[model samples]
Target: MGLITPIGFFSIVQKPSDRTHDTLTVRARMRGDLAALK
Candidate 1:
């Protein structure tokens, strides 16, 4: 719990939106790859 708090704080300070953008980008890539496979 203690370690997680620091990491969470760092993320919010460094780039709060980074995680959401990354998740969307990865989801898009996965969809493209699946479409290609089919």
Candidate 2:
């Protein structure tokens, strides 16, 4: 039960972190494209 609890918590934490990382990467890419266009 203890091990499973940590695993579940980690899985929940990982999802949002992954999403934020992807959003930041996409924003960075868009900014780079705009800069290149200029």
Candidate 3:
């Protein structure tokens, strides 16, 4: 069906986005800690 391609693409795209989102969150937290330390 036509819907299958988007579903497959979204699954692939979502994983990396989740990883990047997690990495960004961790970096932000580290930056906050650094600011607090200063």
Candidate 4:
């Protein structure tokens, strides 16, 4: 899932499963003004 903010972005991954492991992770990123998308 993803979200947009005034100066950045947010992302999250829940219950990610690999061949031998299940991991939980949270990620974030920065972005420019997405005037067109708004």
The C-alpha stretches of model 1 lying farther than 4 A from their native spots are 1-29
RMSD of each: 12.8, 15.8, 15.6, 8.1
Query: Each model's C-alpha lDDT?
Result: 0.33, 0.33, 0.34, 0.54
How accurate locally is residue 15 in candidate 4, as Cα lDDT from 0 to 100?
Answer: 59
lDDT (Cα, tens digit) per residue for candidate 1, span 1-38: 11233213211122457666653212223344435434
Model 2, which residues run further than 4 Å from truth? 1-29
- Per-residue lDDT tens digits for candidate 3, residues 1-38, read 11223213111133566786664222223344435434
What lDDT does candidate 1 reach at residue 19? 68
| lDDT-best of 1 and 4 | 4
Better of 2 and 3 by lDDT: 3
TM-score of each model, paired residue for residue:
0.23, 0.23, 0.23, 0.37
Taking all chains together, the TM-score of candidate 4 against the true structure is 0.37
Candidate 4 regions with alpha-carbon error over 4 angstroms: 17-24, 30-38
Backbone clash count, each prediction separately: 0, 0, 0, 0
TM-score of candidate 2 versus the correct structure, residues matched by position:
0.23
10 residues in a row with least lDDT, candidate 1: 1-10
> By lDDT, is 3 or 4 better?
4
